[model samples]
Structure formats: structure tokens, C-alpha cells
Target: MMKAGPSQEEIRRHNLGALLRFVHVRGPASRAILAENLGLNRSTIMALTSDLTAAGLVREELPRTPGRRAGRPSLVVRPESTRVYVLAFDVGVDRLTVARVGLGGVILDRREAARGRVAASGGASGAADPNEMVNALAAAARSLVRKAGDEATCVGAALAFPGIVRRSDDQVMFGPNLDVGGMAIGEVLSRRLGLGVPVAVCNDANLGAIAEHERGAGVGVNDLIYLHGDVGVGGGIITGGRLLGGEDGYGGEIGHMVVNPGGRRCACGSRGCLEAEVGERTLLDLAGRQESPDVPGREAVRAVVDAAARGDVVARDALHRVGTWLGRGVADLVNIFNPGMVIFGGTLRDVYLGAAAQIRSEVATGALAASRERVKLRTAALGDDTTLVGAAEFAFADVLADPVQVLARLRGAPASAPVP
Candidate 1:
């Protein structure tokens, strides 16, 4: 049986999506630039832009400085960032964040709260209880959404979670350091939010990879890896410009990779996992904080890194040891994926800044010359907000995929309300 190709309508719809996505990611573009980048003729680009502009997804304006060499300057198309937006949520081991992000990847507003047993306000049952976490997130989200102007409309929403997730159903299968497993977090939160939109849930690390590739350090690189470190480590890999999500969307659990067979036990009941060797606990213990009262996470990590910078021998040695194991895991990933870049996010960003020397030495010794030669290693360009920005990107995906139809439908729908 022969499969039919796309109809003219389908082709136009796809092109509409592609054109909108280009400008949303790359910012404003002239008609000529859009046509050139999208590989479409000027007329075709004009038609698509017209459709988008009519749908209120984009608006055209004069460029600030039209070069004299140009014959009548072409108008520049810019995303209607203020009017079109999405709600982005980040569920982490130690905190919760909700943001209103616009079409052009600009964060308009946000709310945040501390979570986990380590947080000062974390009484014990923190993110583990889905209901409690959902309540906190919903309250913050409502406050954020209430501030939106009447002209503003949310197109979609998504949650970034730090755990193994089944993206197809928004299910958290496992969380070694977190405890929100086996819960329909998105569905539960969706009802509470009353945005009349389903909240998509995905692995935090994967979103980190997507954000980094699109707007962070990995931008313009087709092959890259993003390692997110918090209470534990999770990874996102981009191979050939696409995420290497496995058959079940759990492909990037890079932290649990066994770097030492008979070493310290891990939270996932495994010994010598990369995260176990280099994660929060390892760094804290090595820095000799045996009975610290505060939670041992990013703040504690920063304290250690700061101490190392001040020439504290204990902190320096601790970072060195962890960086050695981190390098081994990074080397293995380099050998396997040969990514052009490897970015460290979350707490690892601090660790990397503190121990780049040790990690590079280990990678030099462990990774093959060809694989490691051009692979740049660095901290996340988006800083600690890497995963949170990723959530915004995820929320914007569908709208970016079909801007005209999605915006039309979203605007036509009744306004969302808080569930009383």
C-alpha cells in the first residue's frame, strides 16, 4: 500500500508552525531572512507571515536601522510576546517554580517556594506528598496568573520534574532522590490550576538539554549533553540535533551509570553510581559537615565551592575527588556519544567551576583523543535557571509547532479560572 503525502493544507500548516518556531527561538527576523532561513521563497514566507499576523501570533514592524543598500526595507516580524504566553512549572528536589513565559522565550512573571526535607520550611513531608506539592504549586501559579493582563492569554503549560518520567502519560516512574514516583502529577495539578489546559510533565534533565541546545551554551551545536545535578544527577543528551529520548523516554539517567563497582551505595540501591560518588551528599560529607543543621543542597554546595575559592584545603580536596568521578562519567558519555559539548547544570555548575582542572585531567586520561579533542566542557550558560527555562520551552512547544491554529483555539476558549 502506498502512503499519500501531505495535502496542501497540511503543508501550509506545517510551514506556519516552522516559520513561527524559527522567529520564536531566534527572535525578530526580516522577511528576507525568514525566507532564507526557512528555505522558502519570499512570496511563500510572506503568505505564512500574513497568516500568523492575522491570527495574532506575530506582528511586523520597521527595523531600527534600514541599511541604505536595501531597496524599500522589508518589515521585521516579531513574536507577540506580551500577549501570547505559557505557564511553565519546575518541580525540583529542593524547590518549586512557576513562570509565565511568552512566545519569544521571555519570562514575564514568576513565583517560587522551597521544598524537600532539607529546606528550612520543609517539615518532613515535602515534595513526596503529591497533594501538598500540588497545593503549593497551584497557589503560586494562581497568584502568578492573576497578574496577567486581560489581553494576555496562556496557550499551554508544562512541568519539569527531576525524575524518571513517562512523557506519553505525564507519569513519574521513579525518583532516586525525589519521591514523587507513581503519581499523575500533571493531571492532578491541571485540575487544581483550572487553566483548562493539561500540564505536560517531563524529565528535568531532558528539558535542560532542550533549553541548553536552543538558547544556552549548547546553542548551534548539533551534538551535546546536559548533566543536571541537584540532590542527585540526571542527564539529557542531544545527538544530531534531537533529544536521545529512549523507547520509554527514560534514556538519560546518566547519573546511575556505574563508575565504581564496589564503592559507596546509591539512593537507587546501586553501588558506585556516578551520582553517588559526586552528588550532594558526597561533597557535603567530604567537606566534613557531619552534623550540619541546614539542608545539604545547592546552598551548601555553593558554600563549599566558595570555601574552595578561599583556599580551604578540605573543600578543595572534596571537589577534586568528586570531580575525578564526574570526569570518568563524562568521559564515558564522550566515548559513547561524542557530543560537541557537555554542560553541567544545577549544583554541578558550581562544582564544575570549582573543579574544572581536576575534571579536565581525568577526561584527558580517560577519554579517547578523537572523542575528547573538540568536546567543550563548561557550566550552564542559563545558570541555575536552566531547568526552569527548560520548563518554559516545553510549555511553548505545541504552540510553536502550530501557532495559528493553537492560538486561534486558545483565544476562542473560555477564560481559565481557579478551581474553587
Candidate 2:
């Protein structure tokens, strides 16, 4: 069997990579800042930075702000021209977004497709094969690679599905929302593209959580949750400064928590689940079905909030309903995980903003005092780019931190090894 923990060399590389990532995300820093940010001494930072500079992974720039005590400011160190890029893909129920992101989380370019069941058709003019969607994604990625114009050394593609993902094998175990099951997306994408670079697959909400933790509102705090209220409900969790994907990578499926006993039925054959009550479809049904003005659920929630903003009773009632269900779900999470922060990401961010106070109020009242004390609820900072950036970071760290995983990708084998 492969080793259980990082090797000596792997530990060194991992620490160095973590140091660089800290600088990349937090911006230019002096030696003091670097040491403070990464908990490394000046000597350690100097040694690792020297190695990084020689490898063209980092550069020093003039400080943007002068110190209060110094005549001349110390040089600020940051990532350099040698950067990696990722083709980040977010596959939702009705849309697919592909973005070209740099190593430092900059979105260099992007493309989006407004696809629904048609995406299932896979551009075949008729059929909706999961492989067909993968093929379309491959084509989109190829176009992006060509457009990146020489800055692309390797393409790290991250696809976020709306269901369970076996990270160990990179297999999309189940995506009932997209009508897919047991598909090895990472393997097929690598074959389709012929690039032999690292490809990753993750639960959409988990990625959202990771994105937020790394670049969005969850920064600087561990024990956080990212609850996604969109077409379907999904969640991502972080604990102890690391993502909390269980042995099967299905640990963060919080939407399936049964909150109501006699509620609506869900795709998972359960009734009264949190997702059944607060999912996009639930809101659409509440707003009335087709021939009654087809308002997208998220849009409907927004309209309800907008009307409420103008003091409309009906809109106010709808928002209250949403807030109540959202609160119950959050209360349960707070009791269970006691996260340090809880972010409202996904389509809900826009709608939730109008009723955020009410939602937090409910959570604060309903959850335990200790749990509530530790949590600070907020909206995601990186918005939709969170997943894409997290995906790129995943690939960058995976490859550099674990030479074995890197060798696996180069040898066209599955990255079954533990992520460093």
C-alpha cells in the first residue's frame, strides 16, 4: 500500500507549497508577514523563498505601502510570472460555466453555456448521454487551452457535480439531479483531452465551501460551512483548516438531513428532507407551475424579496417561509458541527441578502449558545469563482505536494493516492 502520511521530502515540498499559497492568496508580504502568515521563522521563510525564487514560482515586488517606522519600505514578496492555470467548470442544473483561472485565483477568461436537459443530449442533436456532456466540456476546455496562448503548461480542470463524488477515484458516484451515476469524469476527461494533465471532480457544494474558505468569506477561520440553496440543496464543510471529506468523500451532504416528517418527497426517495422543502423546485411549485408565469425558483425568491422590500404582504410571507426553513436547517448544522462561520453561497446569496437578518435571527435563536457564539454567518466573497479557484488550487497542491500523484497523472493512471 502507499504511505499513509507525507514522506520527508513530501513534507518539505508541502510546507513550501503551503507557504507560497499563503502569499498568493493573502497578497504581497514582508519576511515578518510571511512568517506570521505561515508560522515559519525568518530563516525557514528565507530558505524556502530562495528555493521558490530560483524555481520561478515567486517574485519580490516593491512594497505598496511604507511602514510607519521606516525611511524606506521593505520589499514585498509575491508569486511570480511562472504561474499555473486551471479550466474550472461549474455544472449546474440549467447552466455550465468554464473559466480559465491563474495560479493566484485570477480569472483570465471564461465561457458559459445555457444548457439544461439539452446538455444531457451532449451536442449529439438528440441524445442526453453523460459522456456526451463530458465531450462538450472537453471541447470547451480545448478551446480555452488554445486561447490561454502559451501560459498554459498544464490544464487543471475541476468539474463540480450536484451529487456524491468519490475523491479517492475521482468518480462521480451519483448525480441524480443531472441523471448521472457512477461516471469517472476525471479519467474520461483526461482521455478526451489527451493533455495528460491533472483533472478533478468534486461535489458542487463542497467545492463552493472550499472556494469560500480559500478565497471567499470563510478565510482565516476554520470550522466553516457553505450551504448552497439552488436547484437542489448541497453543503460543504471545513474543519481544522482542512476540508472535511469523509472516507468516501460524501460526508458533506447536509441537504439530505430530514427536517420535516410529512413534507415533500425528494429525488433520494426520502420525504420531508431539507432539500425537498427549500430546493429551487419547491419554491417554483409554491409560486405556481407553468402557464402561471414560469419564474425560476431563485428568481421567484428574489422577486418575493423585492416585493417584500416594498412592503408587500405576499412577498413578505414567502420570504418568511424561506427564512424559517433555512433557519431550521442551519440550526441543525450549528448544533452538529458548530462551525466558526456559515456562508450563504450559490443562487441563494442574492435572495438571502434581502432576508439575511431574519435568517440569522432564526439561527441565533434556534441553535445552542455555544454553537451560535462560534459562528459568523456571511455571504461568499469569491461568488461563483470560488469553486474554480479551489479546483485549480487542488490541482496545484496535489501535483507539487505529492510527486506520486503527479507521476500517476503523467503515467495515465488514477490518482488514488491520498491528497497531500
Candidate 3:
């Protein structure tokens, strides 16, 4: 038998979700603009906007300026930033950040804490205790939720982990920087919050790519690559304006790409991986500085950059070496993906700014002439907030996918209930 097509209700729901997603990503738009962009009639656009407004996901208001030749200014539909919020968490090797982000990508409030390594017992490994890390993150998230006031509604939550995350069940598969591999972090966080909203766990680099594509340097660029640096290197690839999550969501582990054969060993049990060749620890070691208990890794990297700015030959040389290796790795990616842009984020942003000349020189020599000319290499525009914003976006994915149903659930109403 031939398959049945979607019903009218299903089509309505899909159009509603598409309209909300467009406004959420592209900001406020007039009804005519929405109709044009979504290829829907004016009446259908009005219906969708009205439903979204009643669901507390959007609001319509008169344009700020009156049109010179119009009967009345077109109403602008905007995401309801004040009423709805998403909690975003960024888990790094040495730090944890929790943020309450509103619908329009505004960070309403945030909290941060240091993540110190768990004390080693007799012959015990010094990796961070997964339980302790979860507890600290839960506490921070709870604090932010409380600070948001009881009147505010949390639509969803997402955690950006510095590791490989299984998309099917939000299981942490591998965390070289964290000790939470195989942990059900999303389930644990949801239980800790005691909130009905489900929490999501995703790779930090993936989130970074989302944030960059939506609001940072990758904006308007369809195909791009985002490389994030923390304790280890990670990557996010965007193709055709969508994140390129491989099957099982385990793709984009660029750090493991071999850069130096038979060189230094990596934490992932690989020799001469890209991360091993150019990660923060290697940079510190090359700068003749040891990781201090008091100084954060990012701060330590900044110290090296600061020293280089002050004409320190050792610091400059260290950055150059790392940049050269980074460039070589990037060259391979360019030849393979041929992206229009390559963004360096996190600590790599500072590293790129410090050694742009060297990186560019290596790319010039290593990458194909046509590919090199088409790609733009730059630092992250969102600064330290890229992953946080990405977490928020990930949290909103469900809501954006099924706007009417998600809103009904949030409102404690039946899916078929009419907007009141």
C-alpha cells in the first residue's frame, strides 16, 4: 500500500515549528517577511504567529518606525526572551560554567566555578572525580535557576561536555579532559534539579560550532569548521548550515588526528596526535612553565601570550611551533572538507591571534592553492560564551522541532488543547 501523507494538523505543527525556529535564530521579523521567508500565505503566517503568541513562545508588536507609504506599520514577531529561558552548562577541564539563556540568545544570568583535580589516593590516578564534578555542576545550575526567580519558566537545559557524547541517550562516551566517561550526566542532572524538563549532554566543540554558526564568525557562512581548544583539541563541522554530526554523534574528534608520527604520547593512547602536539599542556611545557595549582589553564596560556607580547623569545617560539602544527592539521581538514571558513575558539583563539603569521604561512605552503584562497581563518567572535550559547541552542532544539507540543507540555495542557 502507498504510504499516507501527513495530516492537516501535522502540517500545521510543522509550519508552526519552522516559523518559531526562524524567528528564534534570525531575530524579530514582520508578518510579511515571515510569510515570504517561510513560503506560507499571509493568513497562515498570522495563524502560526497567533498560536505561538498564545503559547508564550513569541509576541507581536508594532514596528518601531512607521512606514512612510503604509496604512499601518507591520507587526513584528519576536521570541519571548523574558518569559522563557534555557539553562546552559559548559564543562571544561579546569572550570564549569552555568548560564540562564533567554529565547533570543541573551544570557540572563550565569555562575562559574573552578574544577580542581581530585586528590590522588595511594597509587590512585589523579583524574577528576566524576561524582564530585556532577555535584558541583548541579549546585551551580540550581543556583542559577533559583536566581532566575520563581516567575521565570525554564524551557530546557543542556550541558556542553568536553568529550564524545552519545546522542541517542546522552551518555558520555569518552572524556580525555574529564573523568565522566560512561556516565549518564543528563539523567543525573535532571534528578538533581528536580525539574520536569529533560537535560541534554553534547560535545563542547559541537556546541561551539552551533553558537558560531548562529551568532559568531560563522554567521552567513554555510560550510565551516570550528576548532576549540581546552585541555584537548576538539572540532565542530558545519555543512550546508547544519552541524555535521556523524552517525551515532561521535564525529568531530579532530584532536585525535595524527599530526606527528612517533612523537609525544596523547592521553587517548595515541602517539603524535594533533592535541598532543599543540594542546595547552604542551604549550606550557614549551614555555618552560609548569601548571600551577593556583593558576587556571587559560590564565597560564594568557601568561605565555603576555610574555610574548613583552618580547620573550621562548614564548614566541613556543606559540610558533604550536601554530605550525595546528596549521598543518588545519591544512588536512581544508583539503578534505574545503570549508569556506575555519574558526579557532577557546584558548586557541588567543593562540591564533598570537601566531597568525605562522599559521597563515603554514596554510599557504601546505593547503591547495585554490582551497587556501577560499578559506578565511579567524578567531571566535563570541569570546568565552560560544559554548554556553551553543548549549542553550541545543536545549532549545526540542522546542524548535515541535513547538506546539513542547509548549503544551510546559503549560500542563493536552497536546490537542486550543490556544487560550
Candidate 4:
């Protein structure tokens, strides 16, 4: 709501905030375009841009991409190079991946560590100790922060887990693979790492969906579903351009959605869950006569996918079977939401190279005519980097909201008098 009479100072600050947000989300913009986009007068744009420049949050540069030559091509304004970078941690069962990201979705560096965890009860289903993994992850994050150098103004981290996440607060409500039912990831990591940055934790699949929607295949669409096909089948739903965290932040657990009345037992203690049916382990089993002694489940599936792409009929058939299951699961989403697109991401998409065509074919055949027309199926364009990038985006948003306060916290400064 617009205030009846906003003071000139307030209006200027509001306009500057809006302009910064636009640049942060959409990258660089020329003064003419920004003025037109914000519907602000040229003088206002000039003033706001100058203030941002003084804050070291915005800068001007010649256009990076080619453009029309109309009177010297005015410089474009963008977030400054010294703006803080977001740390993204994409946690998986067998690997812990990290990326240092800046505004505009640029990844400065990325690395991965082994997922050797101290499991519970000596069962394969149980992953490494949650506390142990968190410690290691925090250390890695600290090292990365140092590596990012002093220019990293603030940090925003999102940990992608295979579990139910609480929406109102970023907590791992439950994660089967981690062998922990409820975990407060945000609180623990913040204390241990002391990076002085806000942390946002969420399900890996949901982040995958976010990454897809923001920069990958689902871009320009308002409503979509992104499915992660890897060690397990997971899903994230976006409706009206927002990630629907649901009542429990577990709304997109489509992998656990029953595809068959009676099927394989899922690790989550359910029978016939989609994850049980067509997860990476299941796909690997169907791909080869027997599991290779030396290869892990994910690698085995990748091998088969490589074989399939090289013209192996049996491997192709296996991939098609997984694709068929994918389509079956997507059909349910279409029936309910009628999203504009369904993006398939993660290891499954990599394994099933032609899987999108198969899912599309089945959806066209099985889904309602209107829903089918509304949805277009495709694989993720960002590949496995989707979750990491999405987490980075989440972090950037968090930092930009209250940069001064966050920076104070990061630098161990006491807050001044509260706003009355």
C-alpha cells in the first residue's frame, strides 16, 4: 500500500531499494531502461544510482552483450563486484557440494567432498552422523569463506537435505537418510561456523525446483513442477511463481507419492513409493544383470546411461522404463495443478537422456486434454548445479533485505537503538 504522503527521503530510499532489487534479480540495466522500468524520473534514477554507488552496492559498466549503437551506448548499472557472495551447500547422501556465488547467479568456485558418514545402527539406509556432517560442512564453509577473500560482504547459505523441512522456520523436520528425525540445521551451523550470515535450509528437491524455475527450463513460467531423479525421486512445486512449502514444508514429496498399490518397500517405511520404484538404485538394478562390485548405485546408473547413449538397446530400455514411471508420477501433478511446465532434473535426467520425450509422450497420452496442453515437459538446463545455484539465490535475497543489520551481525558489532 502506498502511503498518503511519503517524505522525499522515504521515497528516495524506497526507489533505491526497488532499483537494487531489480538489478539483483535481473542483472545489469541501462539508465534509460531502468528509469522506464521503475517509472521514475531521470533525476530520481540518477540520484538513487549515485547513492547506491556510494554504498558500493551498485556500479556502471559498458554493456557486456552486444547492443544497438544509439549515441555512445549509455553505461549499464549492476551490482558491484565487491558485493557479498553467497555460500551454497548442496548436501546429498554420498556427497557434500559447495559453491561461492555472487549476485546475478555467477558461481565463483565450486567443490565437492566425500559423503563418508558415521551411520546409525550400521545400516546402509542410515547416513553419516548428522552432527559430524554438519561439523565438516561448517569447516568447509569457513574455508570457502576465507578463500572467497574479504570482499565477501555477507553470506547466505541453504542446505539441501533429503527430508521434510519446516516452512515458517528453516529446520530439517525429518530426514530418513540422515538417520535423524528432527534437526535444527540453521541454528547449529550458524553457531559453529560463525560466518555471521543467515542460513536457509530446505529440501534438495525443492531447491532443485527453485533453480529450475529461476534460471533453468522453467524460466518465464508462473507455475511448474520440478522433479529430482537421483538416488531417490523427489519433487518441488512452484505455483503462481512461489515455492509452495506447504503446511509442513514437505508439500512436494511427490517421490513418496504412491505410483503402485503394491510395490517395493521404500526407505521411508512405505510400500510402492515412487522413490522406491524408480530411484537411482532401482534404475541401476534394472540396468545391469547385477550390481557391479566396485561401483556405487548412482555411478552404476550413470554407467548404464552412458551405455544407453552409446546405442545399447538394453540400457535404453531400462532408461525408458524409468521415464515411463516419471511420466506416471507427473500425470498426477498435472491432474492436480495443471502447471505450465514439468522440469525433470538431477541424476535421473542425466541417466535418462531422452527421458523428457518419454515423459512428454506419456503425459500427452494419459493427462487431461486441457492439462496436457497447459504443461510442457523438459529436463533441467543447469544440470546438477540447480540446487546449489538456487540456494545461492535464496542467500542473495536474504542478505539484500537487511544488509546493514546482517553485516553488523557478521562483523560482531552491537546494534544501535531500536526504531521506535
Best by lDDT: 1
Candidate 4 clashing pairs? 117-128, 118-128
- Each model's TM-score? 0.95, 0.84, 0.93, 0.88
Model 1 per-residue lDDT tens digits across residues 1-420: 998999998899999999999988999999989999999999999999999999888999987787687487778999999888888899877778899998999989999887755332344553557778889988888887778877887888889988899867878899766666477989888888777778999899999999999999999999999999988999999999999999999998999999989988898888999989999888988999652434547898989999999999999999899999999999999999999999999999999988999999989999999999999997899997899888889888888777777877777887566675
Residue 147 of model 1: what lDDT? 88
- For model 4, residues 1-420, the per-residue Cα lDDT tens digits are 966898876676577767877887778998898999999988889988887776667788898876776677788998864466778888876678877787667887777876753332354433356776777678777777678776656547777777778878887766765555366877777766666555788888898888888788988898999888656778899999999877778898998998876888887888878888788767766776454324555666777778888898888888888778777878888989999988877776774465667766777787899888867777789987877877887777654664434444655653232211
For each candidate in the order shown, give its overall lDDT on alpha carbons.
Answer: 0.87, 0.71, 0.87, 0.75
Question: What's the residue-level lDDT of 354 in candidate 4?
Answer: 56
Q: Model 2: per-residue lDDT, tens digit, 1-420?
A: 976886778667776777777766776678888888788888988888777765555677777665688477777777652355667777776566777776566777778765544321233223246776777677787788777665344535677777888878877777766765567777777777666565788888888888898788988888899988667789999999888899889988888988888788987889988888777666545544321223434555566567778997766666666667778889889999889998887766765686677778878788999878868878878775666666666666654464334433544553332221
Candidate 2, residue 368: how far the Cα is off, in Å:
2.4
**lDDT by residue for model 3 (1-420), tens:** 998999999999899989998888899999999999999999999999999988889999986667787486778999988778898999987788999998888898898988674321223233266777778778887778778786667889999999998889989988866767477988888878766788899999999999999989999999999999987899999989989989999888899999899977898998999999899989999999987646778898989988987899999999999999999999999988899999999999999999888888888998999888889998899998889899999998888888878867776832231111
- Give candidate 3's error at residue 50 in angstroms: 0.7
Off by over 4 Å in 2: 1-11, 39-44, 64-73, 117-127, 289-301, 399-420
Give the clash count for each candidate: 0, 3, 0, 2
Against the true structure, candidate 1 reaches a TM-score of 0.95
lDDT score for residue 283 of model 1: 91
Cα RMSD, model 1: 2.3
Quote the positional error of residue 171 for candidate 3 in Å: 1.4
Better of 1 and 3 by lDDT: 1
Candidate 2 weakest ten by summed lDDT: 118-127
Candidate order by TM-score, highest to lowest? 1, 3, 4, 2
